[model samples]
Target: MTRRYCSLPRQSVPAFTPGLAAERLGALIGGRRMWVNGTVLHYCFLEADTDASVIPVPGTGETRRVPWAGAREQLDVVRECFREWQDLGIGVTFAEVSDRCEAELRIGFQLGDGSWSEVGRDALSVGAGERTMNLGWDLTEPGGRWTALHEIGHALGMRHEHQSPFAGVHWDDEAVYADLAGPPNHWSRDRTDASVLRKLDPAEANGSVWDPQSVMQFPFGPGLILEPEQYHNGLYPPGSLSPADKEFVLRWYPPADVPAPLVPFRSAPLGLGPGEQADFTVAPLETRVYRVGTFGESDCVVVVFEERGGEPRYLAGHDDGGTPHNTGLRVRLVKGRRYFVRVRLHSTWGSGETAVMCW
Candidate 1:
């Protein structure tokens, strides 16, 4: 018998504006959201001895463990990919079980939360120093390595590569994601909310160009599998990490403090003298950018600077939690000749009315 799959509703195209350069820039810079500190993650692994037609997961329950032969090999592959981050002085350790550590990362076989598709469930769960990752067994099938890598990227707080600045080059949303998979299933208000937060979080980087070969990217579409230039019989072959991917891993996950260029922007500022704060706006000239959270959330802020003659110059500084309806910056300016000032805003999943001040 032929298997049947549920088809999702079509998505509406984002209306394109003619000359909203800042909006465009915001989209670009916003694509590279960062993770936050004191953020913990949990991952669960499920194994089935017999290659069952499907895997099962409880919709709401503590993580469980199963047995499978491919678990170690799969873990090794993930470790190899993550080694790059480790080298970058980023801390990523593994624990035996969910309770063993404050944060958990789960992996398993099959698809769905036993109700719908596995990928459809929340891929990452964020809590106070705790988050969770669910890696389904379906990803262990032959040729599913790319999916494995992509999900791991999410576990590491990385967003979809298609959301990257270089997304224009690789993304053919209509063709590639025509039959998209998993929950947060289609782009809805909830999905948009998550995307907005992921984009602005300070732990994410800003101004970094999207690396097409980053393991975080999907390998089945456009330049990824089928290069626009090298069309092979109207079909594109699967793609993997390029030299750049290896380099990024090595550099990002350095064993020590990697002497990398300073990220061009800043998060919202803090510790303002009573009644003294900075105000700004969210404007992306040619890139997608976000404002880090301040006030009620994390304490970090983001700022952007321009070079003036020989010294770096400040353009703007933003404060957190002024108001949500307005994305403009609001802070007290001190007696100083700053180059310029602007503010950016980002949204979090459960936290309401958070702000990040940036210049």
Candidate 2:
């Protein structure tokens, strides 16, 4: 039987789930790395020399430093993907940087390394001067666009749609293991389990209905999923961002600029629904440690950014982060310095129940 190499894009979840994701945690420019709406994140490409050519071996606790093997002819594909995502009109902005030391995303293209990316805020934790993303194959191929989009989605905090708890996919484990063990993938049983067979924690799932065409899904050929019988033949996404993908991101990262008017010491109501955010600008009168906190019963994350040269610089972060406690953080403020507090709610008990205050 002729194997399909196209299905073997070899795309993995970069470290927040596996590794580049983990890489992001240390590489963060500022001490904090929360995805506050309207924040600007920069990405840089790895060139020859230093750790630019290093690839961390996933699950083996090892790494390899070798010459870059990327298909330079299609070099601009990643940037193109970022542009397409920006065209979606989300609040967060993406920029390219020449220095890896100053970038939130350090990408590499070592041949045979397989395509993967850092997931979300973890990009901040990536070791300084290390690569947090990689692409092994040429992005000019048929599935290349989707691969880039999918990996970027991960970097932006989107998890695998197939791993969604709402997705009722029951896999025929043996068939999946056999298929992935062959050409292009050669994944071991453990690797296959971690990538395809494993299910995500329900808490991590974004709680949306499974959109089969989500670009953040793995292309499982026919006869892999035994349950959800509709997918028994195969579950191949259309190789593009789905409507849900755009909607999900848009809800979390709105297009309109969030103002900083809800001043310090004044409790302001967060007039947002699920997946909505509020930005509060604070102008400190004196240098001191201050506390910002959310009141009443609500689930949210709070990120603080200092305005530096017209850009928001990360300062600190705190969150309910899936626990019962409301989010709060204590950050030092410099006299006359302007700062912004971004609060995003995952869910709230009632319309007027959630509010935040800084003092």
lDDT of each: 0.35, 0.73
Could you give candidate 1's per-residue lDDT for residues 1-359 as a string of tens digits? Answer: 11112211122222322453443334323322222221223343434344233334568555544433245766666555444434444423323333323224545433332111112112322332222333444444554565555555555534444344433343233343332333323444444333321233222332166554555543342322233444312332243544555454333332322212212255543323211223333333333343333444322233433334422233433323222233334333232222233222332323444444333
Segments in model 2 whose C-alpha atoms lie over 4 Å from true places: 1-34, 52-64, 67-74, 227-230, 271-274, 322-326, 335-337, 347-354
Q: lDDT score, residue 64, model 2?
A: 75
The candidate that wins on lDDT is 2
TM-score of each: 0.41, 0.79
lDDT of 1 at 53: 37
Query: Candidate 1 has what TM-score?
Result: 0.41
